[model samples]
Target chain A: MVDLILGWTGVVLVFIGVFFLFLGALGIFRLPDLFNRLQAGTKATTLGVVSTTIGVGLIAKGWLVFSLALAIFLLMTNPISSHALGRASYRAGVKPYKGTNPDLYAEKVKKESDQK
Target chain B: MRIEIPQFIWIAWFVIVSIATILATIRAIVGPTNSDRAVGLDTWTTITTGFWVILALYFFQYILLSVSMVYAILSFLGVLAIARYLERGL
Candidate 1:
């Protein structure tokens, strides 16, 4: 009984994971600029990876420990890396897509520089 | 009796992941800026990690799970290094 339940749950979770990944990839393609693409890729792909790990854990019961470790590492690094990439890109002068709001970061940096 | 649902689901997931990989590859190739390519590569790495997990489950090998974990760490560092380089040197 437990095996059957776990088997089905695993199947569903894997499907959801794959679909989320597909959506992330789609977002990378459809979004207009670098920041938007980074946002989409980081958020969606992180969730997809965690879901897939958990699903694989359920399917392969003995490997749950490693699966959980993979999920934890992914949760830890995905956002930090995305932030680093976005910050680097911003500092490197990749402008936001046209018609965006005032550059608050730029203004703040300028003010800091002036004060210094 | 063994059910075949797991096999079917794995096959379906493989198909979806393949499509996603192709999409990421396109983004990486066509990216106008370095950051765009970095984002695409990061997405590709995460997807590949999931693929490794699925393959581990399919093959009933526990070691490959740790392999994916290590892969994730290295990929994270690679992106971080690229980000730092882009920020400081470019």
Candidate 2:
């Protein structure tokens, strides 16, 4: 009975992960610009992985340590990478979206704000 | 503690992640500029890390977890490398 329950839970968790992954991909493809695409890709993928990993760990039994470590690693590093990508893209002179509400660059705020 | 998840579920998980990777690939391909592609690639790498963990689960092997750190480090260093390159180019 316990095995049955664990197995069923695993199936559910796996499905959830897949759903989130599909959402991430959809966001990546649908978003208009690099910034938004990056946002979609990182956030959704991280969450999806968390769900999938936990599910797998529980189903496999005694992998709790590995899953916990993986979750921590992903949560920490994914954001840092996202930040780096954003900074690098900005430095590379990629233009912001035309519909942007504020033009910090136009106000000479780019450098000063960056320094802060 | 009895758990017996079907193997097919793991396979399904793999399929979904692969699809995500493919979608990321599309962004990388249609990226309007170098930076756009770089960001796309970064996102792609981040997803790939999770992929490794899933692979480990599917195979039910503890040793594979050891390799996960490598992916983590690569994703970390890859971004920093891009940052340095972009800064120097500016």
Candidate 3:
């Protein structure tokens, strides 16, 4: 009974994760600009993969600890990598989409360059 | 008798993830700028990590879990390298 319960719970979680993974891919394919794509891809996939890993752990019973560790690692690194990519792209002069307001990062970059 | 997860569940997972992979690849190939390609690559790697976990469960292989973990670390480092290269021109 317990095993059946865990199995069904895991199945539901895995399905949810897979759905989000597909959504992230769709966003990457359809989004207008690099920043928008990064925003969509990073946030969605981070949640998707983490959930999937944990679900896999639950299904396998003995493998839960390892899966948990992988989920935690993903949660830590995905955002940092996305942030680095965004900053690098901005610094490299990838223009934001037209009508993007504020442009605060560009101003900050300009100020830093002036200081140096 | 030992109950098992239905076989169709695995099939469904394979189909969905494959589609996701293809979509990401298309973006990577067609992206206008290097950063766009990097974003595609990043999404692809994350999706693949989830795929690997699913594969491990499907095969009931404990060792594959470790392999996926290592893959995750390597992909993270690779993305950081790409970002650095893009920023400064390596």
Top candidate, metric lDDT: 3
TM-scores, in order shown? 0.93, 0.86, 0.96
Residue-level lDDT tens digits of model 1 in A35-66: 89998999899999899999888876666677
DockQ head-to-head 1 vs 3, winner: 3
RMSD of each: 2.2, 2.9, 1.5
Candidate 2: segments with Cα more than 4 A from true spot? A105-109, A112-116
The DockQ score of candidate 2 comes to 0.61
| Local distance difference test values of all predictions, in order | 0.86, 0.75, 0.91
Q: Per-residue lDDT of B1-90 in model 1, one digit per residue for the tens?
A: 222554566678899999999999999999999888988998999899889988887777888888898889988999999999887743
Candidate closer to the true structure by TM-score (higher is better), 1 or 3: 3
**In candidate 2, what are the lDDT values of residues A1-116, reduced to their tens digit?**
77677767866886787678677777888888778877887788778777777776767778767877877887888788787777677756777787877666545536655776
Give Cα distance to truth, residue A38, candidate 3, Å. 0.6
Q: List DockQ, one per candidate, in order.
A: 0.70, 0.61, 0.76
TM-score of 3: 0.96
Native contact fraction (fnat) of model 2: 0.63
